[model samples]
Target chain A: QQQVKQSPQSLIVQKGGISIINCAYENTAFDYFPWYQQFPGKGPALLIAIRPDVSEKKEGRFTISFNKSAKQFSLHIMDSQPGDSATYFCAPYRDNAGNMLTFGGGTRLMVKP
Target chain B: NAGVTQTPKFRVLKTGQSMTLLCAQDMNHEYMYWYRQDPGMGLRLIHYSVGEGTTAKGEVPDGYNVSRLKKQNFLLGLESAAPSQTSVYFCASRSNREGQGALGRANVLTFGAGSRLTVL
Candidate 1:
């Protein structure tokens, strides 16, 4: 995809471990970077979001770290548990005339208890 | 609040068949989008509507078409389904009620549960 490049197609983590997924984009016009979480047979839901102006944003146990100059952003999940196992995707949005979203391939994370 | 609802949770179609996916939102969002999710390819945009009576192509709009006759409804139609078109379809809506209005950082997207379709 020409939009964003995501890493680690699949990841396995022990209970209470940390899960990390990284995504990089080439479009400087992208202003909103958000991560979506999807469980089996479910639609992807917004997990966290960040604006280009902020370097990092943390909510609950999820944190989004953005590097504007590097055009990269990553999602970090702390104290990951089995219930946290799900697929994560990085989608960046550009609000020009309308909202245009480009998503990464996705990362499937399995947290084993 | 029934943020977004997609009809037909699952469907199976033979090659050359046709189907339509419906997405309805109660949030009164101005922007609605249809995306197909395939393995490895992730989620690819099929079509989008900025507002009622407006539709635009996305990255993978070649195999699909869309219509937004009402502010809360967006419809996706597959004229002739192909085997390669088998994938999970998602509908999303965002209220552009954030930031400078034109370019807002708070454009939050709410996604539908999803509609699974198979074209064999």
Candidate 2:
């Protein structure tokens, strides 16, 4: 079963525009949500994360909005730049087993200059 | 610290062949993971290790075997190469912790560059 589902296989946005990616999960046991950014030929790095206890969490230009009832979460990037172009993955953590993570399909975002 | 690293950045294998992918982490992490990435399937967990000498199956563990002989090393072996197993593989490690803001909560996964395998 696919625990987490992400939409928009690929996306393009103009520079300085807002970029949004959505994700949904079926497992309600997950409490922690995190987003990762990956560049070509490199590993993915932590971008932003949020706990279900909070409705939203923002860090600089990156924001993660969570809806516990809907079992969905989203990542929004404000004032996106070309440098922000990369693959983004949304992952949820299940506490049942050694804090294992369930990752989404992933979304590739491209910011046009 | 080198964090997490994988050997054989790129490899080509023939059907029925056998090979092993090595992953090493120097951070003394308690949790280790192996994931495979495909075009649209995203990253699927093949196997994982909670600690040294412990291994567990994940989402797609078929035709794959893993070993965590040493705390710093994790190995993934394919007994018989198949075209379906051709994909990019990643290794991750995280420290152990408890409660909120703990050391490792699955939010931060230090991954390697990834090993690209091709089976023909």
Candidate 3:
């Protein structure tokens, strides 16, 4: 099984502050990195994703920064709000037939008012 | 559309009891998966099916059995529930159409609200 390491098991940020979560993968074969957000008692939903071809991809207040050489990717949330508080997971996959997506430990984010 | 629906949102079973979790998708997806989410351990795949009448074991498939009799439905069964099996189970589905999305067709998975199961 491929190992996925996520940082900051937990985080706390003030409203309007930036919240960052990191993920490191050991497999270079992975071509797609996606982030999922899960609120309490709810299933995870796709938040954002980035292909290895691009270094960074941003949508609204969320951004995904990828580093091919480093085999790592990070999610940055700018001006994060209390509504953004949730558990985030980094799921990377090879994007090929029969390949299963690997998920990280997850980072719990708490945004204070 | 009820993307994916899981039955028995919450269930409690005795250690030796048996129960099955049903996952139904209305999107006509060909691929379906069953995953168990544990605290601090992330979600681990228990079983997955690429099409009807086919099933494959995943990372933690020890005491779980899965069957895909219909394209839109996947069932997970536990012969005998155990305390270790207490966790949240999630069902997800994806389309088989290629080149449907920019990131690729197999990258996205629409998950169900999840079912909470506990074995006493």
Candidate 4:
């Protein structure tokens, strides 16, 4: 069973357009929600994250809108650029002694020039 | 600053072969993790360590073992490689220091380049 589910396995967007990816998680105990971006030949890097307390969080063109009651969250990229093309993953974090992240399947995004 | 570093970026092995993948972090993080990325399966944790000399299993720990002998190092070992084990492995580390930096949720996870292993 998938605790965290992400949709749109792949996406295509034009430069300066808006791109969106959605995810839904079943674990209410998740302490934090973070998104990761990965390019070929490189490891995933933290993009942006949000706490369940907040309805939304935005950083530059990357925005994370979270709905606590619905158990859903989505990432929106405004003015998407070609450089933004990469794989995005939604990860819900858990902590024991240290933080552990559980990732969704993944969404590959392509920004067309 | 070499946030996280993985050694033997790529490796190939046959069934029954044994090898170890090394992970090192310079951020002085207390938590280190080993995860495998398989197509369509996302990234699944294999094992993890909270501090030096401690190790614990994750979702997929059947064919792997891990050890954290030093504060900055975590090692994942495959006792007997199988074709099913072929995938990209990632090592990551994180500190508890949050609510700092530009993002309120600071001290986030830092990942290595990755180690790609192929088993035949």
Best by TM-score: 3
Candidate 4 displacement at residue A26 in angstroms: 2.2
- Lowest-scoring 10 consecutive residues by lDDT in candidate 1 chain A? A93-102
TM-scores for the candidates: 0.92, 0.92, 0.94, 0.92
Candidate 2 chain B, poorest ten consecutive residues by summed lDDT: B98-107
Give lDDT tens digits, candidate 2, residues A1-113. 54789988899999999999999998887767889998877778888888777788888999989899999999999999999999999988753346456689899999999
| Model 2 misplacement above 4 A | A95-100, B102-107
Model 3 DockQ class: medium
Candidate 1 Cα errors over 4 Å, as ranges: A95-99, B100-105
True contacts kept of each: 0.46, 0.41, 0.39, 0.54
Encode model 2's per-residue lDDT on B1-120: one tens digit a residue: 788999989999999999999999998888899999988778889999988999988999999999999999999999999999999999987766543543234426789999999999
lDDT of 4 by residue, A1-113 (tens): 33788988999999999999999998778667789999887899989998777789999999999898899999999999999999999987653336446688899999999
Instruction: Give lDDT tens digits, candidate 3, residues B1-120.
Output: 889999989999999899999999999888888999999888898998988999988889999999999898999999999999999999998776653345533447889999999999
Model 3 stretches with alpha carbons more than 4 Å out: B100-106
- Tell me the lDDT of model 4 at A75: 98
Candidate 1 positional error at B110, Å: 0.7
Please give the lDDT score at residue B40 for candidate 2: 75
- Every model's DockQ, to 2 decimals? 0.47, 0.49, 0.51, 0.54
Best by DockQ: 4
Give candidate 3's iRMS in Å, 1 decimal: 2.6
Question: Per-residue lDDT of A1-113 in model 1, one digit per residue for the tens?
Answer: 34789998999999999999999999888777889899988888888888887788899999999999999999999999999999999988775447557689999999999
lDDT measured at residue A81 in model 2 versus the true structure, 0 to 100? 100
